[model samples]
Target chain A: QKEVEQDPGPLSVPEGAIVSLNCTYSNSAFQYFMWYRQYSRKGPELLMYTYSSGNKEDGRFTAQVDKSSKYISLFIRDSQPSDSATYLCAMSGVGTNAGKSTFGDGTTLTVKP
Target chain B: DVKVTQSSRYLVKRTGEKVFLECVQDMDHENMFWYRQDPGLGLRLIYFSYDVKMKEKGDIPEGYSVSREKKERFSLILESASTNQTSMYLCASSYGGYEQFFGPGTRLTVL
Candidate 1:
């Protein structure tokens, strides 16, 4: 089984709606969680980052990590057309080699205006 | 701001050709990584370097090799390009945490 699992969603929603993207992992050793946003024909960019099990908020995005359940989520409030992109979740274990992360398949979101 | 730049934004190569994809970062980051993005497969790490002259294989390192002769530059080499190697290749650099800065990907088409 893949260490990280995410729903490959081409989810479409109207503008101003709330969007939630999630991912699950089987590796309990994972301690650092991250969310990345990628546009068409572009490389993924770091959106939000959190360590261990907790929640971090940045602008209109919120990232939540539950270590016990091995689940992580990104919530977007008031979604806009500009927010239409693929969201990927990644995690890495604690140690010297923690820079290497396992990534999810990614969920593609389209917010229509 | 940290910036990562790739040698090419798009490349087309024939099978059996020796292919080289280069990446350079402005930030003096210690960690550099190479990854390939494919449909439904997400980003798969090909190789990574922790320091100059050091290299490590990632999960899917077959058919690929990496060179890190300099701290700011990393290169990925495909000994013999194959049709199956066609995909979007991405390069990233990090200072030592989960946050990674990525460059514009290089879309490679191997025919």
Candidate 2:
């Protein structure tokens, strides 16, 4: 099985809808979880990051990790057209050097007017 | 603000041509990485460097090589560009944490 798994979603939501993005992993060594937002042809911007589970919130976005189940989530509240983009989840072990990051095949989001 | 800058926002090159994609980070990050974003492939790492003159191969390092002569600069070289190698190239820097700052990306097209 691939180390990380995420549904490639072209999820469409109306304005003000709350969007949820998720990823599951099989690697027990993973300790760092991150969500990155990519606009069209631009590179990804780090949105939220968390270590050792629980949840972290920043503005309209919230990131959650469940180490027990190896599941991670990103929640976007009050979605807007500006939120239309691809969201990628990446993870790695805590002490490993920055090497190959297991990345989810991003979920595409399109917020409608 | 910490910035990761890629040399080109877009480029078009013929197949078999040599290409150089440059990346420079303002922050003195210990780790630098190169990844390519494709529609279904997501972001696949091309190469990475932990320190100056130190490098490692990522998942997809077949046709790509990297250089880190200076602490602030990381360069990805496509010795002979191929049409199949065309994609959005991204440069990222991190300080051994979950948070990574990324360059704007270079979109390359091989004709």
Give residue B42's lDDT in candidate 1 (0 to 100): 86
* lDDT of predicted model 1: 0.94
Q: After superposition, how far is residue B27 of candidate 2 from its true place, in Å?
A: 0.5
Clashing pairs in 2: none
Candidate 2, A1-113: lDDT as tens digits: 77999988889999999999999999998888988898887778878889888999999999999999999999999999999999999998866664446789999999999
Pick by DockQ: which candidate is best? 1
Candidate 2: share of reference interface contacts reproduced: 0.64
- Clash pairs detected, candidate 1: none
Error of 2 at B59 (Å): 0.3
- lDDT score for residue B30 of model 2: 86
Expressed as tens digits, the lDDT of each residue in A3-110 for candidate 1 is 999988989999999999999999988889999999998888989889888899999999999888888999999999999999999998878888888899999999
Q: After superposition, how far is residue B78 of candidate 1 from its true place, in Å?
A: 0.7
Q: Please give the CA lDDT of all the candidate structures.
A: 0.94, 0.91
lDDT (C-alpha) at residue B86 in model 2: 90
